[model samples]
Target chain A: MRSTVMYGAGDVRVENLPDPKLEQPTDALVRVVRACVCGSDLHPYHSMPAAEQGTQMGHEFIGVVEEVGSEVSLISRGDFVIAPFAYFDNTCEFCREGLTTSCEHGGFFSTAQSEAVRVPLADGTLVKAPVGDDSALLPSLLTLSDVLITGHHAAVMGQVGPGTSVTVIGDGAVGLLAVLAAKRLGAEQIVLMGRHQARTNLGREFGATDVVAERGEEGIAKVLELTGGKGTRAVLECVGYMNAYEMAIGTVRSGGIISRVGVPQYEEAPIGMGSLFGRNVRLAGGPGAQRSYIEELLPDVLEGRIEPGKVFDRTVALDATPEGYTAMDERTALKVLVRP
Target chain B: MRSTVMYGAGDVRVENLPDPKLEQPTDALVRVVRACVCGSDLHPYHSMPAAEQGTQMGHEFIGVVEEVGSEVSLISRGDFVIAPFAYFDNTCEFCREGLTTSCEHGGFFSTAQSEAVRVPLADGTLVKAPVGDDSALLPSLLTLSDVLITGHHAAVMGQVGPGTSVTVIGDGAVGLLAVLAAKRLGAEQIVLMGRHQARTNLGREFGATDVVAERGEEGIAKVLELTGGKGTRAVLECVGYMNAYEMAIGTVRSGGIISRVGVPQYEEAPIGMGSLFGRNVRLAGGPGAQRSYIEELLPDVLEGRIEPGKVFDRTVALDATPEGYTAMDERTALKVLVRP
Candidate 1:
């Protein structure tokens, strides 16, 4: 099998590797059908500490179940399934409460940007694709594994609903999808905060009612001005930087909520009482409970109610995965889908 | 008229003052029946900077309306009323949304520890007492102006309700009242975190199911142990110190809420992503929207369903207002009620 490996910063390679096999009673062997480079993957690609050897990369993938261990019950061999970014034993107390991302028995995808991979907790992790081998729906189904569901998580956490106004921060794939998610949830106004004209255009297409090109204080002022100096009812914090967090907090109304999905990078963010307490702003969201959301959103993608897969602006063969990294790093592509 | 004034740190005096007059068409002059020194009042009382003249003190009071301007409609002359800690024009958009503390035209109580006060926005700021001149209910009705309502705000903001477990992180007057509020809201289990045995005893009487005297890491461990290692579903942050904030954050389960009514004193509180995002903990609350809550809780107080006024352990006449401050400062009194 051929797999993508990251040796160090700026060093990605495609190399032949031993095929994965079912190991645990709950494990299943999956043959990769579709995979994508996630925004979070770039975090390690750009500055991860050097390693003595290459590490398997990719946590977002759709695949066909090649074989299943004895304990696997929910899925079977030859079934097309989406492997949510993280595998969880969905029966845990946390999973029961819809927090599968924090499941007691959960692990991230490993060696998934490859021809074959072993999925642990198979029964709980694999969501069978509603349609059989629909190549055109592959990108959309692949997104369900991570980014689309993540955007939906942000919207849910932000309490976006009918008649409410929402502000989405960032223009990355997830942010754009968040606009779509907020729209799907019936938000009356969706404000997308992105500086780039091209991405903001896509955001408009995805249902942004307004776009603010400014950043930092200027961006907050613009948002406040647009919302009658009250700020939006809900803010989607799709970027994890400190400034982005600050802006999300500043761009929300007195009783608004700020939902964050981007993996935060700060170790010590200041949460002043004068700001959060006085304004009654709520902050919530983390890694998406993709497994919990996948089933809920799968029918929408299958029915063409939402086309979140459009975020994949480029697609490449398994051998060109390294170029996918460079394209996204250079801002030349919004997202890169990989066919194995 | 006589009023209590703060000349400087450790200096409080009762001095004669001219009677207040209704200045605005919406203003009303009230003869104070009862007032109290608050935990927050102690903030300035302990170390307020020296000044050329004394500053008016007190924000919690219940009084009889002596005269009303032409525009004052909700309250009138001879009506006993409870003045919320903060006065606001109830017609504002914020006030309509039940956030009176953030009303467009809102001001905190000043010079309220006096025989007479000029109440601005009288129609919106005053809630007519259900019964006239019920001296036994004075303490309870007075609490609705601030402390009791503040505690209820913490419970409501924390999303406490039937069957949920809550932890109240203080044993002061507000904290004890928070326990009462949580119980009234149907919380199944209430944990009060305080070291003082007397205060914790009051907490128990107020419906605290458990009292954990430990602080910091030990406190967190105790709470986690109490809740089967899952932490409580809601936490009432009644103490504003950084340690209490940290404990509140640490004592809540993933997706739980921390409602804070304590006026936070720290300029910079650490909110690491590792703690907030990873756990999906929510932080909510500010100064209580007292006016919004007063009307709802007033009936309970008036009907004797709740007796929040029991928090006042000492009483002093207008001339001995300094002793009221000293009793609270010396930890000899949970609360001090002043009769002018």
Candidate 2:
């Protein structure tokens, strides 16, 4: 089985890894249909995370169930499913409360991002999709495994509503998808802040009414100006950078919401407590509890109401997974979808 | 008119000042029946604010409407009323949205310690009592002008609910009333962290199930331990100190609500963004819209379902306003009510 492994900074390689066998009654073996590079992946790519040699890469994917243990009743062999980024026993009190990402038994699917990944708590963590010959859309659906769900979480947590003025910081795939999510949630004004014309165009297509190429204070000013000086009613902080955090605070109106989906790359987010308090801003968004929003959003995607898969600017074979990682790392691709 | 004035740090005096006349059509004259010292007053008392000699100071009071301008129709002369700490024109967009404290035309009453005060937006800023001659309860009702309302705001903003566990930080009148507020809101478990035996007793009377004498990390740990290591579902931060802010965070469960009413004495609140995000805490609360809660809560108090005014542990004559401020500042008083 081939899997993506990181040997050092800026070094991702496809290597033959041993196939995974069910070690627990709750586990299911997933033959990778599609997977993608994530923004968090860039952390190690840029030498930001601890340098661990030969670590498993990637945490987002859609796959076909190749085998399932007796305890996995809902899903079976040949079922196509989107695996939530976090493995969780959905029956837990926290999971029942729609915080599946914080499930008490939650763990990440972290064996060398292989062809056959073993998913724990399979019955609760895998959401089977309607079987189809739709190979092309698999990459996009695989995105549901992370970015799309994350984007939707950002919007839902922020309480984005009809006529809400939404400001999205970070033009990465997740940020672009957040624009789509806000649009799906009925936001009237959508502003995307990023320099790349292609990604910003995707954001525009997804319902971004305005785009600011500037960064930091200038970007905040642009958002405020676009909002007629009142600032945005909701801000989606998609880049976990200090600048994005400050912009999220600066651009949100008093009593507004800031939903942050970006994985924190810094030790602290540069949020001013005084400003957050005085403005009465509500900061929300955590590791996306995909189960919370997936059911609600999946039907819309399946019906073509939203095209979240458009975030995939490039797709490659599983053998070229390393190249896919490099494309996204070098900023040549918004998102790279890899098919096994 | 006699008013309270701050001559310098630790120098609050009762002195004769020029009476206020109608400056706007929305203004009215109120002969203050009762006024009180507030936690915010301590800021100026400690000379933390821009020092101005002989600055007028008070923002909380209950009184009789002695005169009303032609435009003020809701309130009539001789009506006993609770004047909001911040006067707001109820007709404005912000006020219409129920955010009266952030009203565009709002002004905080600051005649310092005053026998008579001019209240702007009388029609919108004052909540009249249903009955007269409740003078014995006026001291408690006076607290409605600020502290009680702030406590209610904390409960409302924190979304305290039936069966929810709540923690309150700060033992000021507001904090004690927050215990009452949480109880009224149906929180089954209430923890109060504070000093002063009187305030703690008042909190217990108000339905506090636990009291933590320790401050900072120890207090937070005590609260978490009391809640079986998961922390409270709702936290009311009544003290505007950095330590109080941190304790509020430390004592709440993931996805808990933190309603903070403390006006930060320092320019910034020391909150780590990572902790806030990781814990999924929703932070809210500030200057409360007293008018909003007074009407809803008056019936409860009238019915003896709650007696927030019981928090007034001492009373003083208008001539002794100086003593009231000194007592509260020196920690000799939990709360003092001033009578004219």
Candidate 3:
């Protein structure tokens, strides 16, 4: 098996690695059909502290079951499935509450970047598709493992619904997908705040009604003006930067909701309690429970009701995995799908 | 007319000032029957901002409408009313959304700790009680002017409901009143984290099932333990301090609500967004829209179904305004009602 690993900053390499084998009775082996580099993965690729020795890259994928452990009853060999970024025991109280990302025994599946990978709690974690001989939508379905679900989570947490106007605070694949999610939920308007042409166009294709290139106060002002001075009913913050958080806060109306999906890169953000309280804005969001949205949305993708795969501006072969990381990091691609 | 003026940080003088003649068509003159020193009033009293020139004190009061402007038709002379902490034109879109306090033309009632005061937007801002002789419940009704309604707002924002376990993070009158609000909403369990005997006693009397005397981590631990390690379903942060915010964050369950009513005194409180996001906690709260909750709860007070005024342990004449401030500041009184 071959997997991509980063030895240091900007040092992505694909090389032969030992094939993953089931270590627990609840685990099943899957041969990766598609995978992609995530923005969160870029954090370590650009920074040294998070880069561990021999650490495998990637946490999103769709695959076919290669083998199964004794206890894995739901998943069998040759089954097509979507694996979420995080693994959870579906029977846990937290999982029952649909916060699978925070499950007590939850762990991430970064090592699944390789050709063949072991998935823990396989029966509970993998959502198998009934389709056969259909894998072209794998890239978009792979997105269900992280970005798409996360965007959907942001919209859901913000209570995006009919007649609601939403502001998406980033233009990454997740942010673009958030526009899709908000639109699907019947939002009357969706505003994307970013500068990249590819994702910006993809944002429009996915349902963003407007785009604001300005940063900070000016951007917030635009959103406010667009919302008729009351600010948007819902705001999806996909960038974890302080400025991004502040802009989200500034653009949301009093009693509005700010569903932030950005992983905070900084230790502190300007979430003024007094201002938030005075404005009566509700901050609701978390890591997307991908499994929660994947099943419902996968069918739409299969039926071509949504063209989420348009977000993948570039595609590469498995051996060109390093190029995918480079392209995404340099802003050359919104997302790069790798087909093995 | 007499008005209460903040001559200095520690000096609150009740003296004859020029009678307030209506300046706006939306204004009305009211003779105050009762008013109280609020926690916010103590802010300037403790540390006067250099720019806070000789401003009138108090923002909470229950009064009798003595005169009405040509524009004030809903409220007429001799109507006993509950004047919200702020005046608002209820026809505004913001008011229509139930955020009366954030109304575009909303104005706070100044000179509230006085004999006669001018209330702006009288018709929309004042809610009259059906009973003209409900003076016995005036103190509780006065609580509805600010503290009681603010407490209810916190409960409402936090989504506190039957079967919900509530944790109140302050011992002030608002915090104690919040426990009552939670109880009224049928919260199965109420935990009040405050040490004041008067407040704790009021909390218990108002259906607080548990009282936590511990301050920071200890208080949070007790709440988490009490909730079987899941944390409270709703947390009302009544104390507007950094420590109180931290405690509120630490003591809420995943998907729980933290309704903060505390005026954030510090500009830079380290809100751990990581924990907030990871746990999927809903941060819903702000300076309460007191006007929104007063009408519904006033009937309960008038019927003796609830006694919010019991939290006021002391009373003083209007002339002894300074003493009332001193008593509350010195912790000698849980809350002081001043008769004008």
* Each model's iRMS: 1.6, 3.2, 2.2
Candidate 2's residue-wise lDDT over B1-340, tens digit each? Answer: 8888887888777788899888888889988888888878888788744456678878888778889998999999989988878888888866887778668788678873688888888898998986564565676677678888889888998988899899999889889989998999899999999977778987998999999999888888888889988888899988887778789878988888878887755444433445666656677776786577888887877676777888777888878888888888888888888777
Candidate ranking under TM-score, highest first, comes to 1, 3, 2
User: Model 3, range B55-110, lDDT digits (tens) per residue?
Assistant: 78888888888888998899989999888888899988888888897889896777
lDDT of 2 at B295: 83
For model 1, what is the error of residue A137's alpha carbon versus the real structure, in angstroms, after optimal superposition? Answer: 1.0
Q: Write the per-residue lDDT of candidate 1 for residues A1-340, one digit (tens) a residue.
A: 9999998999999999988877899999998989989888898898977887899999988988999999998899999999999999999988898888878889788677888889999999999986666578888888898889989999998999999899999999999999999999999989999987888898999999999999999999999999999999899999888899899988999888988898888866656665677777777788885576898999999999888888999999999999999999999999999988
The collision pairs in model 3 are A277-B286
Q: Model 2, A17-41: lDDT tens per residue? A: 7888999999999888778788888
Off by over 4 Å in 2: A49-52, A267-273, B49-52, B266-274
Please, what are the lDDT tens digits per residue for candidate 1 over residues B1-340? Answer: 9998998999999999888887899999998999999998888987799887999898889999999999877787899999998889999998998888888998888888888889899998998886666579999998998899999999999999999899999999999999999999999999999998998998899899999999999999999999999899999999888899989988998878888888888846655567778877777888885676887898888788999999999999988989999999999999999898
DockQ of each: 0.65, 0.42, 0.60
lDDT (CA) per prediction? 0.89, 0.82, 0.85
Evaluated at residue B99, the lDDT of candidate 2 is 76
Candidate scoring better on lDDT of 1 and 3: 1
- The reply for model 1, stretches above 4 Å from the true place, is none
